[model samples]
Target: MGIITAGKYEGQHPIHPKARQILLDAFDQGWADPTQISSQGRQAQALLDQARESIAKSLGLKVDEIELWGEPELISPIAIWGAPGFGVSPFIYGATERSEIIGMRGKSKQFFEISVDIDGAIDLELLTQTLQPNSIVAIQSANIETGVIQNIKAIAKAVVAQNAHLHIDATASGARFVKPSYWSTLHFDARSWNGPSGVGVFALKNGARWSNPLPHTRPTRAPNSFSIPLALAAASALEHWIADEAANSTRLKSLIERVRNHVKQTISDVDIAGNAESTLPNIISLSFLNVSSEQLVAELEIEGFSVASGSACVASALEPSHVLKAMGLLTHGNMRINLNHDVQDGEITKLLALLPGIISKLREN
Candidate 1:
C-alpha cells in the first residue's frame, strides 16, 4: 500500500497531509537562492534556517556542524577524500550499510575493508588486531540489510586507542536504535546520518576537518541547497517517529517474537536470521528450507502481503543479499519482514497464519 518501501514514513502511500502542507509552504517561501540578500533570497534564507534548525535538533547537534546534503551517500567518500594524506590504510566495514557506498569506493586515494561477523557486525577482535598507525576507520553504526546493530561505542573506543579518525555511517541507524549524542561522546571526527533518507545530515564535530566531494568555489559549494525542504520534512518525521519509539518497539518486538515462535512451531526447518536480541525491532529475516526467497516473496505478494526477501533496495538483483552472505546464513528463501509505524499485531498474526501453508506448498515444488 506504500509508495516508498523504507524508512519511518513507510506504508503511508500518499504523503502525510500535514507533512505535505509543510513542504508546500516551505517551497512557496523558498523560491530563490538563499545565498542572495534580495527579498526572495531572504525568504529562502529563512526557510533554510528553519530546515537546518529542525535537522540539527533531530540529530542532537548545532545547526552549523550539520552539513545538509540531498544525497546521503556523498558523506564518507567526501570525508575520506578530504583527509590530509594520512598515508595510513583506511579501514572500511567489510560491507557497506547503504547501496550507494558500493559506487563510492575506489574514488578515494587509499582504503581497506575489515570483515564482519556472521551477524553482519564487524568483528571487534579483528578490528583491534588490525589497528595500526595512521588508520582511518569507517564503521556503519547499524547494518541496513541484516538489521545487525554494531557496538559503535566499543568500536569507537578501539578506534580512538589506535589514534585513528573514525567516520560513522549512521545511514539506517534508527534513532531508537542508536543515539547521536552517544557518537558525539565517542568523539567521531565526522559522521553521516541519513536523516531518514532524502535528508542527509553530515555532522562534522567541532575542529574536525573533512573534504567535500563536490568542488565549487569556497563561497558556493552546496550540492543541493533546496534540499532544505526535504530535510525539514524528514526532521519532522524523525521527531514524531523517535518520540513513540519505545512503545512502538515493544509492540513490534512482541509481534515479531510471536511470528518467530509460530514459524518455529509450525515449520520444521525454517531459519530465523539476524541477531535475535541486538537487531532492530522492526526487521525480521527468516528463510524457509528448500525454497527460493524470490518464490516466497512472489507468493506473499499474491496473498496481499508486501515484504522483502532481503534488502528491499536490491531485491531484484539475481544474487542473494550481501548481508545474508556476510552473516554466513542460507541466502535462499530469505524473507525480510519490515514492520512499519502503523503495522499492528493483528497484521503479524494474519501473516503468520498464511506463512506455514505457503511454505508447505512452495516446498512441494
Candidate 2:
C-alpha cells in the first residue's frame, strides 16, 4: 500500500536531491569543530560560514544578524523575554499561536492573548489596542495547524510604534512565504523546508534590543553549535525552495482547493478551517461531526494514509487543539493535511475520493 498523507507533522518534506548529496559530501568536514584553529577545523569553519551567509541571503538578512542554533526552542525564550534594558515586559501573542509561544505565558512579567477571527487570523485591531510600550509581542508568520498566514508586516509596524519588540515564529512559513523585512526577530526550523532536522536559525535584526536569557559565563551570543553538514543542507534546501516557490505554490494551491471543495461537497456536517485566500497553499484543516480524530487517523493509516489532528507539533498529546478551540471551531473529528513539494496529483485525488466514504463509515461506527 502506498502512503498518502496530506497533512504532515512539523512541515516535514523529503530532502531535495541536491541537499542530500551536499549533506553526504560534507560528512567528513562537518565532523570537525569550527571553533578550533587547526587546518581541518578551518575548512569546517569555512563551510559553516558559507552556510550561514547563504541562509542569511535567502532571508534578506546580513550574516551577522543570524545565528545557527540547535532548535527553535533553544532560541525562542531568549528572543522573547530578554530585552536589553528591560528586565521583563508584558508578553502578547495571538490566541491561535502555537504551543511554544503559549508556553511563554508565565515566563514574562505579564501575559495577554489577542483574539483571533473565526478564520484563525489574529485581530489586528485588538492587537493595536493591546500593545504597550516596552512590551514583547510574539507572532507567527503562519499557523501550523490552520495554515492561516498573519500580516506580520502590519503587526510589526504596530509593535514598533509602541516601542515594543516583535518575535516572529516563521517556522511554518520558511519556504512557503518570504520573510517580512520589518521583523525585529525571526525564528525558523530547517525541517520546515525539506532540510534536515535538529537545526534551527535564529535571527535578530541589528539594533534590536535583546540580551541573553540563558545563564552563562561566556559572552558569546549563540549558546550552542549545530552540525555543519546539517546547516549546509538546510541552506541548500531553503535556496531550492525559494527558487521553486512560485511554481510550487500555484500547483499546491490547485491541489489543496480540489481536496477542500471535494470534501465540502461530499461530506456532511463538516467544517473547513482557515482562510484559503490568505493561508499556506499546501495545508488544509477539516472537521467532521461525531467523529473521533484519533480513530479516524488510525483508520486512515490502516488504509495506508497518514494524517494528523490537533497541533502537529504536539500531536502526541490527547487534549483538544487549542488552535481550533481558540478559533471558536470544533476540535473533534479534525484532520490536517500538509502537502510537500513532491506530493503528486494522483495522491491528492486518491485522498479526496477516499475521505467522504471514510467519514461516513466512521460516523456510522
Using lDDT as the measure, the top candidate is: 2
lDDT of 2 by residue, 1-365 (tens): 65544454443556778898999998854466778788988887787888889998887789999998876566676677665433366788889877777887867667889998888888999999989986778898898788888888789888878887788888887755566656677888887877888788888898887777778798766776677888889999888877776567789899989988898788889878986788888788888888988788887888777777874333676677888999888888888888777777988887777888889888999
lDDT of 1: 0.61
lDDT (C-alpha, whole model) for all candidates? 0.61, 0.79
Report the Cα lDDT for residue 76, model 1.
60
Q: Estimate each model's TM-score.
A: 0.85, 0.93
> On residues 273-309, what C-alpha lDDT tens digit does candidate 1 reach at each position?
6567777666677877788767787777777787666
User: What TM-score does prediction 1 earn?
Assistant: 0.85
- Candidate 2 wrong stretches, greater than 4 Å: 6-11, 84-87, 311-315
| lDDT of predicted model 2 | 0.79
Location of the lowest summed lDDT over 10 successive residues in candidate 1:
185-194
